[model samples]
Target chain A: MGYEEAFPPADMKWAGNAAKRFASPFVDVPHDRIDVDAIILSHAAVASGYTIRDFYEKPELGIHCVAYASAMYDLLPVTHWFFSLPWVTELGIRLEYKDTLPPIPAAGQEHVLKDPSDVDKIHVPDKNELDKGWTLPMFKRLYTYVQKNLGHTLVPISYGFDLVGAAAELCGVENFIMWTFTEEEAAKKLVRKYTETAVNGAEGLADTFGSAMLIVGSVLGNNDIFSDEAVKMYSADNMKYYVNQCFRKGAGPQVFYHLCGNHETDYKVFKDTLMWSPFTVIHAGYKARDPFPSALLKSEFQDRATCMGSVDTKLMIAPNPKAVYDQAKKQLLEGRDSKRGYILGTSCETPPYTIPGNIYALTRAARDFGTYGTW
Target chain B: MEVIMSDAVKELIGKRGLKVADVEEVVKNGKAIQKKGTNHYIASKMIGDVTAYAEYDLESGILKKKANVTSAYSHRIKLIKVDKLDEVSDYVMGSTPVHNATLQMEYMTVVRSGPGLATADGSVLMVEEYLATKTLAVAEGLFEKKRA
Candidate 1:
């Protein structure tokens, strides 16, 4: 199983509803005859109003299956892996980089960022092209480096989930929402086109560099833009259509649907549309209205879907380490009782304001209370 | 969950020098436990000038009865502790000093908001003492302008 892309393709009108389009990789990998079990699609959609069918042109690709794979090497030095492995055929790597959008100008010659929230972490104008032109070459470079260096661990180099909210920032919220209802056909065409461009780029890179796995993500689940009704009506069908097309294509890459928002109502729709049976992982803040009551979601999904994210991120920033620890403990206990897969994570991004002591508490709870079994 | 009086509460009662007999009648007469959600908020209310009771059955415990305060109200019991005599007396006596301290603190931390502060709506609130003082000052000609 592979995890879905957390990021989304720029200009996807219903990117917030992209979670609904999630397809499990386990289903598609066998169809595509790929030995790899998982894949990720960084945020690249097809042309306006076009479906995933239009992108891959075949129906065998598993572009919507979501699952999680190991990232054992992401935190380690790439050079070390190059020198160590001699028996493997290819190198697998996960690439993540910050965005570079120019700060909004307050006055002439003085650039002022509206929110001093992520002042230190963000830079200007280094964003992934929404056009999906550069991602292919980037993958090629990464794969080539891996193959030329040691030719080991080269299986599935999941690309990324790009800057979560970057696309919304590029094309303001109101315009994006209006595009969904007013220009539905055009929007679908654009998604299909962009998605194809990205897949083409990914495929070209894969063939050239001798890589297998494809990974992608960005913020497609944030609820600040479209409402649930609009998503269900316009976005859900398109997501399903695209995922179906990916299945038709012979792309061995598994699909992953990732996002970072509190979209509780869309869970059923996401599961239905993505068809995440037997394989895949759904990682987000599944904040049920009643935590004690909704503990069953963990058991119901089992290995098919793993709910991630730590207790609310606000706990740590509240200067309450105990709150963080307690939340983790509660989630693990809930997971154990429900017989479902649970991953320790934050509800959202690990903000710079977060205290390091509270962050470490997550590890402590996992160590103290974790066990290996469903629930 | 069983509710047990904490050691801090016991020490507090001891510090107040209250005995079980002091609240014997209140405990006997104070029926009906205040149902706070699922838990009981057992408390008692004083009816007469009696500050102490004759005797209390520590084993049988306080009697329980239906609440009769108001038709629309929920059931709530008036809790009577062996140490409530000192608690109530100290509470009533402490009020005057607390108010005095608050007044002193107000003077020390005065804010100038045009001599008035509005609430949620644009309605000004004037302190009753300030209003009375101002009215008296005007009656006594204390606020009158002198001849230039």
Candidate 2:
């Protein structure tokens, strides 16, 4: 059940060295000791009845590995800003205007779209304009490094883009809701502008990376914060537009869509919008009260795409290690029989405070019970 | 000088044994200072040897409280009065208290205005800075009561 038992020390050492060489500074563990890929696979194999080789052979798994690397290297600067504005304390990033404001300022003070009438002010930055700073060069260096060193084992992907979520960032959440109600036309225009920007950015990255799997990290389009009617009316169309734009003329690479938060009533919207698209993998978070059963995935999305995730993030922080193992084991056991290949992962981001022992426990459970014929 | 008195102001003035006419004489030529909230206004003046600080509710013209201090506590005591005005402004600008007589319940409701803790029901809990800024706006007469 231990990490070494699941992954040979040699494989762990190799992955650790790869992580250290490319991931430095960002990943806290020592260069020769960082083995996130082995950790992911050693645990994943236990749940999916697949060997490490079997996992890597699948392009989807490669995409996930690239997504993790992109995150570790901070390839997506936009996503980092999303985290920094709200949870800077948790991430230990200092705020620039801390002195002028009180100890903590309001969340939306940095919002750009203060007025609905100013939607026209939003502009999609050209590639050169976006590259004027370190983000572009750093991303290029990391992407090139990942593609060169880990390309054979894992695909190099951008953690991906989020149109609606980025729009929420530019337009304060309150103003976003206000505009949706009071100025529907302006809101639609804003969404269109951002969606086009997102598509352009994705295409640009895809061209640079030469075929990378992209992840939309937080399809805020599926968030319950907006009313069901509003989501149906506004968000649904925007998402459909994004999908169409990304796939049109082969503008971007294949996509893996990730959505968080309570979406009990809204999953149908995603299903309906994306049902026909061949360029997506849907990873949804779990609703603790109504866990996403494998049968539901089979019945609802079997023909369209593979489904991943729904392991409760709460288990990652549970007091007892056994709780984490038990939860991971239960999820794997259910997913072992799934016709659509299930990739076991936390329903949401593993919280910053989740302990290493709990993470190891997840892999331990997978290794112990994830044999091909065990189910 | 225009003097307005709330119930609390009358009590403080009566307890201190200061005449309203004397406080008004100083306030008439005082410098006006504002705080965070719309209703909070303070007027400070030095008359001969005594410095008088008067806190006023801008909306209703009610003098919430007044303090008179000799050179020693003049600055410190005036700050104290302004702080009191901030508290009153928070209560006034915050959501109105909801009371259910049938259930014998009473509680004030506040929207989650900034980044902080949130309740299970998704109500954002108030952060200290947000509370300070919001209440100060009310005290400074910068807050306008929104028409419901």
Candidate 3:
């Protein structure tokens, strides 16, 4: 069957509901065609909201695209085959799958960089090389296929490289931590190399797709893993460079940085780095200690950059849909007074098994409490 | 589908010097031997050459479970081991002491006159002391009892 036949667009009933409630741009459903379960779940989620006859009936939801094709290659079985290929294996990078957990990048028990000097071994594949590689090809195939099918209905979000995360994957968390302290020079060099490559790659994707927003996933830059000082010195510094490069390359003005952990201490670094940048959005992931992102929006970023997310993933799993609605209400109320825009979403990716009821409650709460000018 | 460990359980395993992978392997391969609570289940099986246990709380979405059994077993040795010499030294030192020497079986080192004691070995004295603590924890309802 054709891809479109296998995974049909959102149900007309649900689409219509979503369209009535939400503005032109609505919440972008992640991976609505991965399987039968996804299709059913996506329909349920859409039905729960005000929908439009077509996916592109409104442009307000901005550009809705699934970039997971590139970011989460480890989840696919094809990745294992790609890793086993002689050509890919020669690069000294292998995909490590443990039971059912997401695949990790490793060089045997150690990372590609055993020591500081091994920074030279760190290879940031150029665009041509990446296009020829196995994983990227698979990602491109999925992206292109989705674009070809859904492009008319939805804006396609292309993939952008995550430099901080890519560095951690290459060096391994342990070695990366050690290098930060003991081998600062080599660590910095490696980070710089990765940062430059990521900037160029992201710019290229932006140029190709003409996407409205370029999302840079930098979960490793959170304060949970690094001290506030280190976050500024490393993550913040590189982010500044990234934003500058994107603008320089005319990769659209809006840049959304996805940092998916606790960043109470390092949040300021983000503010300082991107507050002045053009049309920035901070996709703050959920933190158990602080379940609200309104403080971030209302603060120094009040008039600057949009803030997205703060809903705890745990709440989505709560048996009571009211719990999800309550949290969503709280998030909306907190951001009500902010001059900056706020987008309601889960702190991170919605778990594949998230109940349809809870997903419905989220959009329901957004419609109930997220009304513009409704305090 | 495999159960994902909660952050609390992950932190517990890290503190106990066990890899999350070890506990995950047991959970994936082990048979369900018992139920602990409404959402929790206990699985037991032999993984590779070692017997393994996993406690999973399934209510929290597809992921999110408490692996108490893995955390318990991973720290079994450290939890059971006690240092009688350090206890003796603490008693001898009382509130004040210039210096004191005591043997720590766990660390395989002699504790020589210090405010705090450090041991590198896994051996300890009076296994009952450890058992008492476990009993206390169980009595305190830290872990759920097996369903009847």
The top-ranked prediction according to lDDT is 3
lDDT of 1 by residue, A204-273 (tens): 5434533233233323533444556544444444444333333222222233344445555655555444
Each prediction's total of clashing residue pairs, residues at least 3 apart in sequence or on different chains, is: 89, 16, 23
Q: Tens-digit lDDT track for model 3 on A1-375?
A: 553443335344443333232221111121211110011211221332423222122112111212121111111111101111112222355764433223445334556667777888667666566556544444345445546754422332323435565665566767787788998888777777677665555444544554323456556767777887787767777776665555455443445676667777677666545412223456666453666476655574554455665678776656888988788778777764444456666776554345657766766676677655455
lDDT of 2 by residue, A1-375 (tens): 322233222233444344343322121111221112111322233233344343333333323333343333222111111121222221122333332221233444555666787788766664455454323344455555445444433343443355555565566656776777898888878767766655555455555754444455445655456766666556666665665454442332245666566666666666555412222456667442444554565455544454554557776667788977787677666654443344455676555345557767765665565444445
- Candidates arranged by lDDT, highest first: 3, 2, 1
Which model, 1 or 3, shows the larger TM-score? 3
Distance (Å) between predicted and true CA of A268, model 3? 1.0
Error of 1 at A51 (Å): 39
> Model 2, residue A282: displacement in angstroms?
1.3
Judged by DockQ cut-offs, is candidate 3 incorrect, acceptable, medium or high? incorrect
Q: How accurately is candidate 1 docked according to DockQ?
A: 0.00
**TM-scores, all models, native as reference:** 0.42, 0.51, 0.55
- lDDT for position B52 in model 1: 20
Ranking by TM-score: 3, 2, 1
